[model samples]
Target chain A: MADFFQSLLGNVTNVTWQMAVMWAIGALLIYLAIKKDMEPSLLLPMGFGAILVNLPVGSEALAPIKTLFDAGIENELFPLLLFIGIGAMCDFGPLLNDPKLMLFGAAAQFGIFFTLSMASVFGFSLRDAASIAVIGAADGPTSIVVAQQLRSGYLGAIMVAAYSYMALVPIVQPPVIRLLTTKKERLIRMPYEQKNVSKTTRILFPIIVTMVVGIIAPGAVALIGFLMFGNLLRECGVLDSLSETAQKVLANLITLFLGLTIAWRMQAAAFLSPQTLLILLLGLIAFVFDTAGGVIFAKAINLFAKKKINPMIGACGISAFPMSSRVVHKMGLKEDPQNFLLMHTVGVNVSGQIASVIAGGLILSFFAGLV
Target chain B: MKKKIFAVLAALLILLTPLCALADNPDAVETCPPMVQSQLEAAEGSITENAEIPEAPEAAEPVSEEEGASETSPAKGDQALSFGESLGYMLKGMAGIFLVTAIIILAVVLLEKIGGKKKDGQA
Candidate 1:
């Protein structure tokens, strides 16, 4: 059986320690992604990609994988294209109604900078730390944007870490929320009055924001513009079918491709290095700090607010989008069934997504100047 | 209580200046090397500073709000990479995130649409 396997590929007798370890790690990620249903779309593909790289196929025929790596990832194409689908999926209505939630978005990015400094202290170069700090975004687009701009060699590891942490957002955020806010604080229900936003406002919201964020950060134009474009399609009232396509068919198909492509980046030798482990650790730090900065900022706001804002929603300030928002809403419900922080949390959550993207673009622009 | 809520909201909005403050123009792409980046990162902090209170609500005033944000920021390399290559990387990095988010949003929208008690007739 071993001889036959070797004949089909390479010599099983020549299996290196690195390849063996990589195969194990790949298999484990597959188990986690599939069996545990933990980010299966990405992990399954990543696991598959990992397995292929470790298959020991000789000759230049299998060089296509390497080509895929050089062509798409090296140029940062995939991350930007996926933004369109993400924008289509994102509903910024909650945020538009409550524009102040943009503060939470800005605050949530505290972790990225804080972690960048920490990563630097821990021996990573500036660009590498910047890439690693994006894991705090808990939003893959932001991470990809930052990493691609940073030219970090471990884009795959950084991506995997970001997605895994995001899927674990529910688990990660609640503990942090609890640690920061007392039960009374969580129970502090703020009434959400749904504003009857004008159709004009909805239509103009994306355009206006694109103008605003674009002028401030031109690099963010691609991300914020596409995202707002998707939102514009949804609310334009003229392109219902287009909106539906962007949200459903177009979004889903792109997601499938995005998942497979990211998985392709996870070569064992490149991914399983000491740097990969460091990237994972730094990613976690970025998240923790992002949560801290957001919650702390919210608490600071509460000190000055007359209506007693819910600090829990502040934690949702991270760019994990609706997941962070949902976590806050769930926590609110746990504290008081009457409390509906969903809209408010969603407001902050969506804003965080926008803010993170802008933050990402800013980081890219910031780091781009270095070289 | 309602008044307090209003007051709370008003106060919270006041602090929101900082949020708008931190969000300078995002078009800046930081892809410079280590040495040049450290200098650029230092400049990034100032852009946040200059990103102070929104001066003009007019969407037309683009660069005026924060010249420092873009004035000194690094420029993107002029590369004419094909759109296909760009699309693939975006998907690879973001497909999982969008998938999960879409599933959740779909569920929420579905629940709100189909399961909300009878229109204007609920208990």
Candidate 2:
């Protein structure tokens, strides 16, 4: 009986403030993911990862799980392979249907460049600054790639900021959407016309994007090429089984590893640092500035147009998917019930998927050369 | 080649100019040489440096294979260039990515405009 008590006390010796903080963080992730339904797959695994990594140095509980993260995530291969599933699952139909939405994609990226400079001024190096800026793109893959390439000291903080902001798109973007546009502007209803992209165009797109973006941003080929390849499988019609696996099983598997591995980087010595707090602060700023850039750009374009585009949808350009679009849609409903920007906003949101990858390539090329 | 270089410069202009202008003491900043490789290495430990610039194979070929993968890969590393000058090369690498995007976006916009105009004319 005494031996059992002593062993339990020995186990409890590992409990430091750092461990407590990490446990709190893990619990927070669980609350947010489960109760709030924010990026459930990502947050749930991340919570589990945090628990496993911080489990008071116990035996038989965490060895294999930690090993899984250590082997794949540290090598940077997991995130890259995850791209194949992300690529394949993406339905470029909305984007291709309204190719003009690609401008919004470019518009969304303004935050990345904007945040890069701001982060630099805040005392981060160019590479860390660049990685932080990618959070504005609201793309987990792009953020992971940029952070991985830069090997930012605050990788955990940056990852958390990127993923959390993505899940909070509905909350974060709505305020910005409301601030940027007037109720009158939100009332601008767009006519929805779904264009049927031909089989040839669908089949050729991934190939063309892979070649074009790959040659230009060779650093991004691993990510964009796989993404486009996934789309290729999706559109090929003959590869339905492959596409299904890419979208469901492969993506699900990779997402788990990615989330947990990121949590492993959340060790106390790293997590409690001031730099992490700064990274999170900069990340939020990126999202805000991105929304501002997209809105201002659209409003400027609308000045030239006889029929103005709904400026609220421009916020959706930041690629939070249904969340960003929903924010725009909700704002629109507030202004006028008949006004619906869901499809248009979704169009731009999808374009953001492509744009963030392009931005990642651009940043990689720039700083990789600098280093 | 010249046009391509100019285009890279143009893209860099769009991305970097705003921040450069925001630096309060431009003259003071201009006076300093670029953040050299050594300084960056020193800072990496003290403040966590992120200066590693992955070099493209073609440009990186002249360096020893070790440095081809790491820092000191740029040709003018031994020389003291200005901040903008060193950053210019890094921006070029980044420009390589944006250049493709800009060209694609511009092309699609142009085509859409032309097609819309033609439709209006027919109407």
Candidate 3:
């Protein structure tokens, strides 16, 4: 009886105060995910994974999550798989209808480059700085893929920042948009016009985009190709079952595994660094700058255009997708009850999604040779 | 024609601003010696190509094992960078993204023109 108790509780005796702290942090994340409903899909699993990995187990016991990390994250499978699901779920109809909004999407990626430089100024290496800057993409998967490609030391912090800031887009974007644009600019209304896009156009759009991005920025081919393939699955109509599977079942499963796998990097020593704090701070700055970039770009364009654009539409260009679009829509409504920017914002928002993938590939391309 | 020219010019200006910034900074990429730069590039390529399994926590005696492992991981190192170099990379990267964006915009504009012409022909 004594020997059995000793064997069972021996691992418990090895638990450090830091492990206890990590458990608390994990519990907090779980609480935020469940009670606060903050990015529940990822936060819940990540919280559980953090606790599971940090628990005191005997030296001989196998760490299962580590295996998941190796299989999923280390080889860059999960993010790419998740992109397929994302592409399947995305409807590019709004963007297709209004092709010009793609400019805003491109403009918003200013945050990633700006943040990269800023992170470097803060004393990060080129690789780590670039990875951290990708948090500004307002994209979780892109951040993960870029950071993994760069082999950044702060992967856990970067992932945490990317997802957290995405969830916080509603809160982060509004003040920045308000600060940049006047009440009149925010209230500027562009009439909603629906232009029918041909089925052939829809089919060709993804293929053309994949080819264009692949040729120009070959490094981004994998990221863009997977995404376009998923979109192809959706638009082709014959692959309805496969599209649905990719959208629902595949996305959910991969997200769960991806969340849990990422926790392998969240061990107390890995996560509790001063650099983690800096990363979180820099991530917030990136979000702010991305919003500013879009808003400012819109304001700049408005100067030359005969038709005034609701400058707030620019704020939706970050890769937060429907969330940023929805936030801009709500802001438009608040500025003027009759203002409808939903489709317009969504258009730019989707563009941001594509632009972000392209930006990620571009970063890898430029930095691949430099690093 | 003028509007199209203006739009294209604006896009080019947006794309070129970063490259101009890179050119302004003389010491940015050139400061790093060629051999070290190549090695860094190689290391980066290999790291991305090979997915080495990260160290996991020991089931038992977790604290001591982790403490030792944590000391050796790259995350703990302090990487210092001067502001100029950071700005250089930032400009270069931003230029690359903007250039791609400019090309995409031109493609979309062409598509729109083609689509409009098709509609006119149909009418």
Task: Name the lDDT value of residue A361 in candidate 2.
Answer: 79
Better of 2 and 3 by TM-score: 3
Candidate 3 colliding pairs = A57-B59, A57-B60, A58-B59, A58-B60, A59-B60, A371-B40, A371-B41
Query: What would the TM-score be for candidate 3 when compared with the true structure?
Result: 0.84
Provide the global lDDT of candidate 3 against the true structure.
0.79
Residue by residue across A6-90, what tens digits does model 2's lDDT show? 9768778778888898889888998999999989888887877776687677646766766866676656678777888877877
User: Which digits, one per residue and each the tens of the lDDT, describe model 1 over residues A1-371?
Assistant: 98787787666666777777777867877898878887777777776777777766573745776676566566666666666667777787786555566667767777776676666666666567667777887887768767777677778888888988888888888888789887878788788777545566667667766776575456667777888898888888888888888778776665565655665566556777888888888888888878887888888988987878888888887988678888889888888888999999988888778777766666664446543
Cα lDDT tens digits for candidate 1, B1-123: 434534544554443322332333322223336674465446444443323212222432455446645433332222211233222222212221222222223333333333333432553
True-structure RMSD for candidate 2? 9.4
TM-score each candidate.
0.74, 0.77, 0.84
Cα deviation at A287, candidate 2, in Å, is 0.9
How large is the interface RMSD of each prediction?
A: 13.8, 7.5, 5.5
Candidate 1, CAPRI quality class derived from DockQ: incorrect
lDDT of 2: 0.70
Residue A71 displacement in candidate 2 (angstroms): 3.3
lDDT of 3 by residue, B7-119 (tens): 77476866454342333232322455788446533643332121111111122245546677653334311343456545545555555566666666666656766876888
- Candidate 3 residues lying further than 4 Å off, grouped into runs, are A1-4, A58-62, B1-81, B115-123
lDDT of 2 at A328: 79
